[model samples]
Target: MHGHQIRRAAQVDRTELWSDVKPGSLYGALHRMQVEGVIEAVRTEQEGNRPARTIYALTSAGAAELIDHRDEALRDTKLRHDPVDLALQNVIDLGEDALRAIIVARRKALAEQLDAWLALRELAAPHIRGLEWTTFRHTELRLRTELAWHDELLDQLPKLMANQPTSMTTS
Candidate 1:
């Protein structure tokens, strides 16, 4: 439909899946797609009191490209650039209490993320129906998976701490 609709769809389905699905990236991609003859602007019109909206549709090339990219996306697993992974690799830079604090903070943040997604799912379920409900379901599942992984790390931290040198130990 329009850019807002496109953004709404991406926010639900692709937001957490892709790091670049934010508003800036969405609009930028639309512009690039138009430039590359993948999509065309049909018209812009004001609806009610809102600002004007431009409706875009896929060109023939766009349609073909969409099918190819969608298939490739489904087949490929993209690597994530997670800050937690970076921290895990260099945690020796921190002292014992610092590492413990970091772990605790990370765990809390992950719990909050799970709670937020679950709350969003609850808020969205009544108004959204059919296949749309799966959006919330999928996001909740992803958040839960991440939370579980975080908790697993927390559980292992004590053992990890025990193996570290005295410099890494906290009283």
Candidate 2:
């Protein structure tokens, strides 16, 4: 597919699968893949006044690499690092107000995201099935877990803020 088509597919239905891909960097990624021989430019086509576009096709090596990547992602269970953990550890220094503000903001954002996913699930329930449905379910579960964790943090905020460090030392 052409770069624009690929980007459109990534965006369709708010799939939440391409969180790491920046739209502007896609063409660059395609270029890099072409250089690496993972994908090749099949042809260029232009019609009327539209600019020429290059269509790319994946090679056998690319198919193998893609499968490897998909398998690794599916099998890998280790949790990725979240900066919020580091911030929470040192949150005592920020005072209670800042911590509350940050947590509140995060909760709001998470709630908004959850709402969007829930809406999508509702809308797509009749048409989606199998692996696609499973992906949606997985994302919904993660978001719910995050929301619960944030609520727990809020419940413990008073205790956490009250027990601030009394001294600091470096060795």
Candidate 3:
């Protein structure tokens, strides 16, 4: 479930999954999950002459695992990275305006995600009951926090970029 959500949310292709999961690798993690009866992949035929794609679905075991790890997953910070950090790391190579443009674009993308997250939360409202509300609430809080963070970053970017030199010369 986590793997699927990560792939879908990041809009990552199979090749990019390696970077997303690193260490044990996405394939290795998926295989391990399957072996442990967490998830099962169903083979589905694709259009044209292409091979079938494996669509993963969470098993009962998988749902239980997700529930068990929900708190840990929410608390884990080591697996995450801020794109702003990546951009700043390469700021010497990418001009301030260029990096600012990237931030604006990322902000737009995150806004779209927040919209989707809100829609999902709305849909889950009546459907989620009792203890499930705790999980849903956590998910909603995380999404809202992320949206707020993005807004804050976008707000602060201009001030941070103001003092930075925008041009570089080749020797």
Candidate 4:
């Protein structure tokens, strides 16, 4: 249910969803979850004489498992690399002006993400109560922290780009 809700809310496809889970492992995990009674196949519908598509929904047990998994993930210390990091890694190829443009683009994207997170937070607030509020609070804090980090990185880009070697010259 967690995966389905997330995918639906985010409007992303299965291929994109697989990126969040371990590579080459999502199908097996989904199958296991179904077998374990955590998730169940809700329905199947055929499309224009093609094979039927199966839609799954989370059972109560699945929701519990999702919460447990989320808690464990939040506790993990491993640093995850996002697309901005990947772009930064290859910045030299783009030159300073282009790199700055990329940073600007990233800032714009972060702003959009922050707005979406805020809306999601608001939507979640009414449903959450007592200690459950703590989870939403944590999510908001993390989003704020990431936005701040993005701003800081944007501020530092000019100086960093200036320090980068422009070219090699020989006489």
lDDT of 3 by residue, 72-95 (tens): 766777957766666575586665
- The numbered model that scores best in TM-score is 2
- Candidate 4 wrongly placed segments (more than 4 Å): 1-75, 167-171
Tens digit per residue, CA lDDT, model 1, 1-171? 789999887776646564555686788888888999999999997989999988999899999988997799879988768887776766666666788787778778878887887777787777787887776777678777887887787778778866755554567
Runs with alpha carbons beyond 4 Å of true place in candidate 2: 13-19, 167-171
**TM-scores for all predictions:** 0.71, 0.90, 0.49, 0.55
The TM-score measured for candidate 4 stands at 0.55
By lDDT, who's the top model here? 2
CA displacement after TM-score superposition, residue 56 of candidate 2 (Å) = 0.5
In model 1, what is the error at residue 19, expressed in angstroms?
6.0
The TM-score obtained by model 2 is 0.90
How does residue 123 of candidate 2 score in lDDT?
85
What candidate 1 gets wrong by more than 4 Å, as runs, is 2-5, 12-16, 19-21, 46-53, 77-83, 127-135, 165-171
Each model's C-alpha lDDT? Answer: 0.78, 0.85, 0.67, 0.69
Candidate 4 lDDT over residue span 20-103, tens digit each: 555356557778879999989888766698766667888999899879877987689887777767666555556767776766
Model 2 / residue 12 / CA error / Å: 2.8
Clashes of 1: 0
